[model samples]
Target: MVALRIRPAIVLFGDSITEQAFGVEGKVGWASLLASDYARRADVLNRGFSGYNTQMALPLLPKVFPPSKDNQEGSGILFCTVFFGANDACLPGERQHVPIEEYAKNLETIIGTIRACFNIFSSAATKDDDKFPIILMTPPPFDPAAWRKCRDLEEDGRANNVAKSYGEKVLELGKSLGCSVLNVWNLLEGATSPEVYGRYLSDGLHLNEEGNRKVHEGLMELIGKDHPSLAPLEAGATGEGLAVEEKLWRELC
Candidate 1:
């Protein structure tokens, strides 16, 4: 029989970037790294929808992340991260183009729905208990010039400046709503040059290994800083087997 191991979980809602958390190469993605690091500490769920914009994601939220009936099954949800906007920022007239204003409203509604389902509206819940912390991660900046080489997108399918504005909106919503914001837009901008930054993405629009690591590091830093209570155990050079051995000896004696 499979052993039952129930632990708090992490719900990651996003687009393709999140879907690739566990890369095809077995263990190269950010989700893979985070899952390994969080082993026995927290369970991570990937709820990514490829080619989906916020408008698409918002409607599906009710079906996928239904109201949390805590203790209905496993350990229950501890945290949730919303990573989207890459596709949503697609230039107008493109298949996935969502107007900038609508995009902002969509994100706000998503957060509100999540809060309602998590029971944040309960009068008895403490600020910490009912208040499920939401992490709003902006989409990573893309290199449209590089993307053009790969294939033809719309007249402005994806551009750095255009993408930055979407991420800026996410940052704005996060601040006003008291949500944790992971600004991949500005974060990846530190790469200095377009070529250097391009290295972070495999297809000019998606994340590569280096990019995954950058994301993982940013997530780790955020978790450690904002939610120390949910941080994973730090690995040391040696295992703690000696302590187990000592416990056995003492019990026998």
Candidate 2:
């Protein structure tokens, strides 16, 4: 009997929230936790960049998924989670409020490019078993009252609303592209309150430890329900069976 070998590679790409590894202590970033959770079964690559928007990330996709010049065959990328748009919303001047139409175009480009790369590089047998699961995560809602304390309330509120609207549009686009949509805005809204996690936010935006956990848990639930391969591993269970626990402790400490 031939053994069915499963090789999973997850690439997490996004903004500061995806890049942050902060907490009171004994805590790891959600992406890192995700990596640790599947440490035994998969190779997780952290490609998250702080303050990167969709436009910026589109160009860097090749870096995360470089094609083999020698045409060497191996297990292709199994999953990719792209979370951008937050920084695009925060950009200065005309670029600040990225039009929903342009945002959709950028997302479509990213997904199309990835599909093209996989088709061009991976083997037919491997590609048949390896599904390219692209998960698009929307940005969580910003606290208007919190933003009021730092920046102009009216302007920030307007920008926040635009971001929310763009997020919804992005979800629609993801559906059109046959990708999974993780509505982080709605997920965080249900799991936490602005008054509670709002204080944990560093700069009227982005999450702290508790907030991060909320996002992570929401993601886990979403993935578990939809992706069969990820059902067994939970956020809290990672770093337990291997040397990851020690490393997690050191980093979190």
Best by lDDT, which number?
1
Error of 1 at 169 (Å): 0.4
Stretches off by above 4 angstroms in model 2 are: 1-7, 21-26, 69-75, 91-96, 119-131, 145-158, 190-193, 196-200, 230-253
- The digit string of per-residue lDDT tens for model 2 on 196-253 reads 5465565557776666777778777776655555444433455322222123444676
Global lDDT of each candidate: 0.77, 0.64
**Could you tell me how far off, in angstroms, the CA of residue 174 lies in candidate 1 after the best superposition?**
0.4
Q: After superposing candidate 1, which stretches have Cα over 4 Å from the reference?
A: 1-6, 68-74, 120-130, 152-156, 235-253
Model 1 gets an lDDT of 0.77
* lDDT of candidate 1 over 114-141, digit per residue (tens): 7777643333222454466788999887
